[model samples]
Target: MTRIFSALVIGLIFGAGIALSGMANPAKVLNFFDVAGSWDPSLAFVMGGALVVTAIGYTFVLKRKAPVFDRLFHLPTRRDIDRPLLAGSAVFGIGWGITGFCPGGAIPALGLGYSDAWVFVGSMVAGIALARLARHTMAARAAGKAV
Candidate 1:
């Protein structure tokens, strides 16, 4: 189908971009995290480039009446910074500092057959599962008026 082919092409492009940008290298990410000795700031340039590209893409998407493939562009309406958001952000930052790999970069890093990448990805998935379980438990407790 057209959608499947389009998705594959998009994924390949994204993967190639990550590889080309040196983002798939754990050492580069680890270097960025290291502030004391031999710290590399090259990742900052990659982040800047990504930010610019994302901003432009978002602007273009907003200008369109509807997305090319989708019936409508679904954007998040929530603007409030709540407790869960703050806590999750803190956890993510700590994990990134400790593991040196975010989910996006982790996939390609895994493709390069790095053992650390597998460990990071496994831990990340476990964390996600644990978070979801906690959320469900909390929701159930709140429903019972137990808080």
Candidate 2:
């Protein structure tokens, strides 16, 4: 229950921050990407601040033996980038550049009644489903089974 409550509070704060910072605005994000054109460096500062805070928070949290709500830290063990990672990252970057709405930004934008956000979020969900299906198919083929 404590974990759940903490998560709720954290999520609310994050969403509010995203909204307030104009990160939920697709045009702002697109402008940030337009480096050779009328580039907006403001989002870079926001990202840098987030990075600093996250680095400090991680340093403290990781020094502990376990998480506050769990017995052990749930961390990703993979260190090597593979084909799937590269492919997925490229796809994500392309989508983000075109739509100016990554998953994190788009969700909050949805709450603010943006139609583009709705479309982006819906497409993101469909992409996730398609990726999962592809993974299952690949796994089945690797095991010499029909998917």
Best by TM-score: 2
In order of listing, the candidates' clash counts read 0, 0
Write out the backbone clash pairs for model 1: none
Worst 10 residues of 1 by lDDT: 138-147
Which pairs clash in model 2?
A: none
> Superposing every Cα of model 1 onto the true structure, what RMSD results?
1.9
lDDT of 1 at 127: 88
Tell me how candidate 1 scores on lDDT: 0.87
- The regions of model 2 sitting more than 4 angstroms off are none
Residue-by-residue lDDT tens digits, candidate 2, 1-147 = 998999999988999989999999999999999999989998999899899999999999999999989999999999999999999999999999999998889989999998999889988999999999999999999999987
As a whole number from 0 to 100, the lDDT of residue 50 in candidate 1 is 86
Question: What shift in Å separates residue 138 of candidate 1 from its native position after superposition?
Answer: 0.8
| Model 1 C-alpha lDDT per residue in residues 99-125, reported as the tens digit of each score | 778888888888877789898999899
Worst 10 residues of 2 by lDDT: 99-108
